[model samples]
Target chain A: MPDLFVGVDVGGTSVKCALSGPDGKVFHEGSIPTESHEGPEAVLKRIGDYVTFLTNDIGGRPAALGMGLPGLVDAHKGISRYLPNMTTHWRDVPAAAILGRQLGCEVRLLNDVRMATYGELIYGLGKPVNTMVFIAIGTGIGGGIVIDNKLRLGPLGAAGELGHQTIDPTGPLCGCGNHGCLETLASGTALAAEGIRLMLVGMAPALHDAVDGDPGKVTVEVMGAVAEQDEPVKQAIQHAAFYIAIGVANVVVAIHPELVVIGGGVAKLGDLLLGPIRHDVRARVGRLFPVDDIRIENSQLGSKAGVLGAIALAIHGLPA
Target chain B: MPDLFVGVDVGGTSVKCALSGPDGKVFHEGSIPTESHEGPEAVLKRIGDYVTFLTNDIGGRPAALGMGLPGLVDAHKGISRYLPNMTTHWRDVPAAAILGRQLGCEVRLLNDVRMATYGELIYGLGKPVNTMVFIAIGTGIGGGIVIDNKLRLGPLGAAGELGHQTIDPTGPLCGCGNHGCLETLASGTALAAEGIRLMLVGMAPALHDAVDGDPGKVTVEVMGAVAEQDEPVKQAIQHAAFYIAIGVANVVVAIHPELVVIGGGVAKLGDLLLGPIRHDVRARVGRLFPVDDIRIENSQLGSKAGVLGAIALAIHGLPA
Candidate 1:
């Protein structure tokens, strides 16, 4: 019997494939470009190549194959439901059928953030928790909620879109078409937007000079540098962080989770981002119901969390 | 053996109690002033007296007792962790142990809102729903989350305090001392404050006259009448409703629960409040996820939800 499982993280730009053992260890891994712009067929072929590469090396002993993707997913039928950046105008593109036909093995697919949280629950900090919220702050913010060792996917599986949670209904429009979402205000996208907005208003000379006068080139890195000294950049960053901290504090007060794991690109800023968030959250939450002990940390799995999380999902509860 | 249970809803102002059979049916019920001002010892005697009245028919069948109270409670330990209003300054009072020893029966105590949601889950709107968000908009906002028919008490039994979710960090200060909490923006206290502010600012004619120019008289009832014609009152009500819609919509998008059970004294306004809340939420959430189908309604259990829910908690978590 195949003791290994195939875990795939299909992103807008790349596909990360991993051969994982039941012991929650990745035995082999490789990456392949996902030209999603070229359409699902070509992308499917790339995914197949990666999966087949690992399967062949393992003497076709992989027990199962699970793929993770961004956007709405129908895990039961193994359908894409929706892939945000894909070229396909999807209204439920069946991912399992496509991936299954390609691999001829038990293939499964799940929401990327949900998979990452599951991976964390079974293997990381969540190992000792009955509940945890996994927030990945990247181009857009998203989340996964793990309660009692299971992903609480509701009737439609639209649960855990924390980034889309309205922080300010009158603020800014999110990629999800909502206004004032925490993700649109505090994620990497928000940081970049703030940087560009500041530059447009004649702020951040170093960033302006670094990007050679092109505000679009003013990425989060430049903003972090500018925030190091520039008052305007620091204020803008603080505004978003303050709101994000309030959001976290509220989630803690409401969901009362054992841990909160934050990952994705923005977490790379380390103390610069987390410091304001921690301070604001503590101040806002009050000393009455102290959250002084709530364990908050960056994703330990780093880039491979999604892949390992998908494998964990299969081990937990993916239909054969 | 008496398979029935007695449930008590202990509030700051009054105590509502009910006798319920194992089949989820209430046999008899009554309400009395809490007079928590009299002290914890006095209140405990009152509770003992009420329990005696409930089972007096057949020399009192020494059955299980369930109690739900406002404030932070240690449900498993049957203790009041912290309650600002309950004169019991008795933090961590093991009421269950005392009552059990006094009455010769096991006792269970829970946070009032959590018990109310549990009631809804087993005997009210939360029926048929494994995942639900129960929000009660009373003098203060209180919320409870039921995941897979199980109440989520977090690690410390504080999981379902959804009223504290921050919709705005700069909005207003909540009774809990948090700024811009959902309760600060959407609860009855918010509505009352808005009404008082509007009347104090000479904004409402009908409401002003309805209360005879006394700011104290501009109650929610007077404000409701003003809403029929007064734009400021309507605007104020709608403003509260708008944020409420956002709060509920965010919960819908986050948990994707099949139903959102809304109850409380303020909900008594019915469509006057809920209509705009529903419309605003739909407008904000958009058709992307479809929340129009989410069931939002007033509590059918009236004030009896707490006790019934308490009973459900004890009976369901019984030997099985």
Candidate 2:
């Protein structure tokens, strides 16, 4: 029997899993409720049970498994040091060893964003390039850096925290207790806040009509929709794009990645967002880079990027 | 005979050369005028002449010769694409090949800051650590990133241009034509400009006395001296340190290097400069790193960092 790999992306909402062939072609995929309220042990057991079920359905034991976790993961130690998005007690879990023992197969673990970036590199737009920077602009901004086709996880395993970079030392305070972090200026949460401010000021008439003037309904999606017709909404996105471009330009100068892949929820805005970011980066970077050679692309693998990257982690023979 | 490596740090004014043992121990070093005004060909020939002289001084042909150049260098192509600080005609010079042919040995090329970073990593404070970020805060603020003990030169071989990063979108014009760049706010040039402004406003009495009331004499060193007692000069240095701290904090979050090594001309300020930078980085980096494990150190090799790093380029073997 050919070796089959299973990948699981653990999230606050649900657990996403996929089964792929040795070549990374997905044969089956599924999701299960994490039920974290039941506690850490229960969630872990459910994950193992789901993996077992998937293997059983294929009528074969998987050769290996990889999981992406939203936590401070020590991949070297195979432990999830702190899972902020999960249960309070989900600390220092020896996840890889437990799952490996449960399935009698090798297990690998990765930070979800890093896993998604690896997925994009091996299976998405980044496949054509040797170096790329992947930014997931969602509720908060985070990034994964690849240089010379190798993931750069520095000594502290926190090398790619691009969102936390201080663009303005005196700007708004970020949730991370810092002032003027990119996340404070350009994240999905920031977009929604800007939309609400516009709505309160009655500048977002189209957005008000879209959400029937409900303040809470002034969401990121509502702003994205209003951005199609409203000048205020468009201006808000452009403002965010301005900060994002500055961040990208900084990353470009620091890493010189040939390609920059934008993923996560905000990337769904597509060219509406990307065009401005590209122009700003080009303007800021100047002769430092060829500028024309740096390609800004959208992530092609969508939500499956994490799972596929987990599979890539398993297939790449694990990190040692 | 044991292998000997020759390292040449080619500058517009002078070419500094060093001979080192196989283990990167410097045995001899010397310098000569570049006379760049005679043009690229003459400069190249002079460099060859210097290499020949160094070879004769060592009484043997070295195993390999390495050079560190000031501007955009394509190490893989062994070409100096543009010599910004040198003669206008020095473009796309196959310097490694030309010097290797002149010396009859293998040769490697690297950016000057990158070469210094490699030297620090292999022989200085960075030797004990696997990852480090080296910043040369002098006339301009440039940086070199090392991940997993390997220098990360991205696709364009132009990564680690930390000085050009725009910390403020509307601060000051940099030599690169960008506004609010770290270089514009924190470089020696910036410090001098601030010092002159303070002097012009009569805010710097001590500085006025130090420079004998001659504004033109108010240089970086004069400012450093006045900073010992003058509030205005101290404030100027502190302000520069604030912006520099922000840039370093941003890098700390992005790369999380185990050590941050400061080199170049301005680092002569020692603990006075390092103290504020460390405080800012620690406060900003916070939970991302231990806030303590990330040691911000001074470059031990000092002025020879570039030449020794060029020697490191020869010892670390060629980039291929």
Candidate 3:
């Protein structure tokens, strides 16, 4: 019988789980509400229960499990340092050990976005490149770096915090306590903030009409829908894309990756978001390297990147 | 007899050559004027003659030779893409092959700053860290990245052009045609330009007196000498250090290296420059990672880093 591996991606609102074979083919997948408001122990316990039930229904014990958690992860220690978006922040949680004992299998943990990068590297568009940088733009911006075809976790396993890089020395305060970070200027949160501001001022009528005059309902999707006809919304997206392009230019100069893969919910806007980013990056980095040689594209994996990358983590183990 | 390796560091003003044993122990060293105005062929011929003379004195051929050149290098193709500081730019020159045919030995090429980084990694303070960032803050700022203890030279061999990364989006024009690159804000040239401006405005009396009221005479050393007692000079250092600290902070979040070694002529300012950089980086990056765990220090190898790194390059070959 072929050995099965379980992969789980824990998010702020849901936990996604998948069972896969050695070749990275998935046999089954499921998602459950995180109910993260219940706190770390309860959330992890529910995830563990779901995993055990899935394996039992298949009538086989998995060889190992890999879980992707949000925020600062000490992958070597199997601990989650801090998950900022979660209700309790999931500080210092021994997540891998707890799940490992429950599932009675070897378990590995990685930063959620890095797990996505691993998935993209092994199973998606990044397969052909030896060096790549993955940027995930959602509620916050996150990043992963693959150099010489190996994931670089650094000594602290906290190497790829790309969003925290200061793009503007005097921009705005960030959740990470830094000012003018890439995240503060370009993340989904930033876009939504701009949308709300524009809507409140009656500039984005399409956005205002879509949300029916409720500023709280403003989101990246709502803005993307009205972006075509709304001048202010288009400018806001362009503004965010401009800063994102600077962030991309900075990374290109720092690492000179052959490919840069943009993923996550905000990236789903496709060319609307990627076009300006691509144009600006070329203009900024054109003098340094042959900008035409580097490819910047949207991720093909979509939301599944995290869970698939988790499976890859189960197969490859921690990066050496 | 033990195998001998020859390393050459080609600079704008001079070319430094050294011969070492297999174990990297220097047996002979010499220097000659680059006289770049005489053109690429003439300069390389002079370097070849010097190497031939050195080997004749030792009565042995080196196993391999490694030459570090300024500006963009296509190391794999053995070509100098552009030597920006040189008279002719050394564009598309087959440096390694030219020297190889002359000396009848294998030759490897790298960016001069990368050569210095390799030297620091193998023979200097960078020996113990698995991941490091080397920033050379001379006339122009340059950088090298070491990941998992191997030099990361991307696909184009242009991965570590750190100074070209944009630190301020609208500050000033850089030589690379970018707006507000780190080089424009924090390099040795930037410091001297700031000193020259202050002198012209009569704000830096000591600096003006030191330079005999000549702006062209203002230099980093002159600024450093007066930094202690001269308030304006101290402010200039602090301003450059602040931006440099931001550049350091950007790399910190981008790759999270275990150590950051500052080199080149401007780094000779030591604590007068390093103190504020260290302080600002800690403040900027403290929320993301344990800044204390990442050491920021000046190079211990002084000006010899490039030649020594060229020798290491000869021993190790290009990064895989």
Candidate 4:
């Protein structure tokens, strides 16, 4: 109805498409299988088909399109590099050009977590705050830095990879090939892995029974349910939260951001996960640069963060 | 003569003052015994006298004056918050007030390292670099940051305390009450202490002869010479350099900074010190980012960095 924009989120499992107004309010949203078994061109067609559905349903084309994907994005050059587990053929994909030409809409491509940070900075809790760091700890930990209401895109666009900063040099191997990365110790995967490790050692009866001896089922969701009754599962979440809180405290001490918006599947544990993080953070918060006023909270945008943040990019970046 | 500016470098033993033109040509320079024994007012007068000499020599006060000190400096308010062992009685002294009243000139006071960073940014190797970090290994390891041609002054003006960053959680006791700080293992004080430790263990024979069994005389200078010939001292220096260079490479791989400037008293060892530091850094340079492309070198301003850096504040930080 209003001047429309299209937002696309490309994930390993699926491609999500949303048609939105210039105000970042989504009008229609839908999802389609990525079908990675098919080549990138076929998967790209599925992504394009969703965009066409939005356009056809809207009675016309959108003015702008914003896309979010898992990758080390070169926003300026419209290229993706060093992405996780995507097809090797996905290297250096001129994604914006291909999508733009097919949809006949100008497109802006951005890193998914950065786009999520954009969602918070503009439409969520961060609108009231000046400096905010958005951390999404799902499949892998990723973050985005916002200063004075603008993204701190580093010289080479590699600035906000705070997840890769080694938390413990002797820590477990990270996907980034580094050791002791915060992601290796505090992400959702870390929580689930710790739960499974404890269960394998015959530590938690309820967690062991809940997973039914399958380690794959011992996920954050299973652990969250176990935490409702079992102490071991709760402890795993507590220890993970403590590590995350300490890492957040370090960030606050170093960067002095006003707020940290934590998102991801792990965060869905809500106060159970947040309580321990807040406690540990309060205790070790650097006395020198006391970020006592720092706010730790959730992403109000919910599952729509990736799309909404891309919508923000369409609204903010493409015009520039 | 062109317009003139006054630069004051407040060191532990003496306060060096210089009069330099806007063209960065030093006109007259003098040093007075800090007589920290005489206290703040006495030293303030000595500083005032230097200001008077410069203003008078240049035929009335030419323009702005900048003072550089070695401590926590709250630059925004033009105050030196604290400097251990220096008797400025400057418990949050509004430094610009005192210096401005004395010389009838606008004044800017800053941490010595930050000033040196400013100096490098304006006229030295940092001119060609977008992101620059300068570390001065002196009584304590002090540092400053300049990125995107702007100083990275955190919310508390304590942005560049690189020395305080933890390298070893259980290393030597540091002045900040933290253990294993970079300063604890690499500063001039640390270097001298390492020499004394080796001598205590009957390891550094040359150092033992150089100091003649006097621990106080075992300075970083003597240790530098010993490290070149003495195996024990070489190992100690190599170990310390190993950590220092690792810190440099971590920052390099994370930020991919264009230039890193190493300075301070120990920089006098030049290639002897940097040669090993570079080797250790090259060893840990990560495969993830463009690490090998980073340029690591000593600060070009050298011994005159203090005064020249103060001059930098005048040129860049002065209110338009």
lDDT of 2 at B141: 83
Lowest summed lDDT over 10 consecutive residues: which window, candidate 1 chain A? A311-320
Residue-level lDDT of model 2, residues B70-173, one tens digit each, is 87888888889877777554688888888788777888998888888888888788887877888888777888888766887875567888888899988887
- CAPRI class of candidate 4: acceptable
Q: Locate the minimum summed-lDDT window of 10 residues in model 4 chain A.
A: A282-291
By summed lDDT, the worst window of 10 consecutive residues in model 3 chain A runs over A151-160
Select the stronger candidate by lDDT from 2 and 4: 2
Task: Kindly list the per-residue Cα lDDT of model 2 for residues A212-261, writing each as its tens digit.
Answer: 98887777777877797889899999999999999889888887888998
> What tens digits encode model 4's per-residue C-alpha lDDT throughout B79-121?
7677665754456777777777876778888888877777777
Query: Arrange candidates by lDDT, highest first: which order?
Result: 3, 2, 1, 4
The per-candidate TM-score of the B chain, in the order shown, comes to 0.92, 0.93, 0.98, 0.93
Error of 3 at A14 (Å): 1.1
Better of 2 and 4 by TM-score: 2
What lDDT score is found at residue B127 in candidate 1?
Answer: 81
Clashes of 4: 0
lDDT of each: 0.76, 0.82, 0.89, 0.73
TM-scores of the candidates in the order shown: 0.93, 0.92, 0.97, 0.88
**After superposing candidate 1, which stretches have Cα over 4 Å from the reference?**
A1-4, A87-91, A200-202, A209-213, A225-227, A286-288, B1-4, B21-24, B86-90, B314-320
Report candidate 3's interface RMSD in Å: 1.0
lDDT string, candidate 4, A10-98, tens digits:
77777777877767777788888876667566777778877787677778767888888776777776666556656544666777788
True contacts kept of each: 0.59, 0.64, 0.71, 0.09
Candidate 1 residue-wise lDDT, A1-320, digit = tens: 56777788888778888887777677787888888877776687778877777777778565778788888887777887777766654557777788778777677778887777767777777887777888887777778787776776766566787787788888887767778888778988888888888787887777787788796687776777767767788777777678678667767776777678887777777767778887887776654365777767888886778888777765556522
- Please report how far candidate 4 places residue B319 from its true position, in Å: 8.6
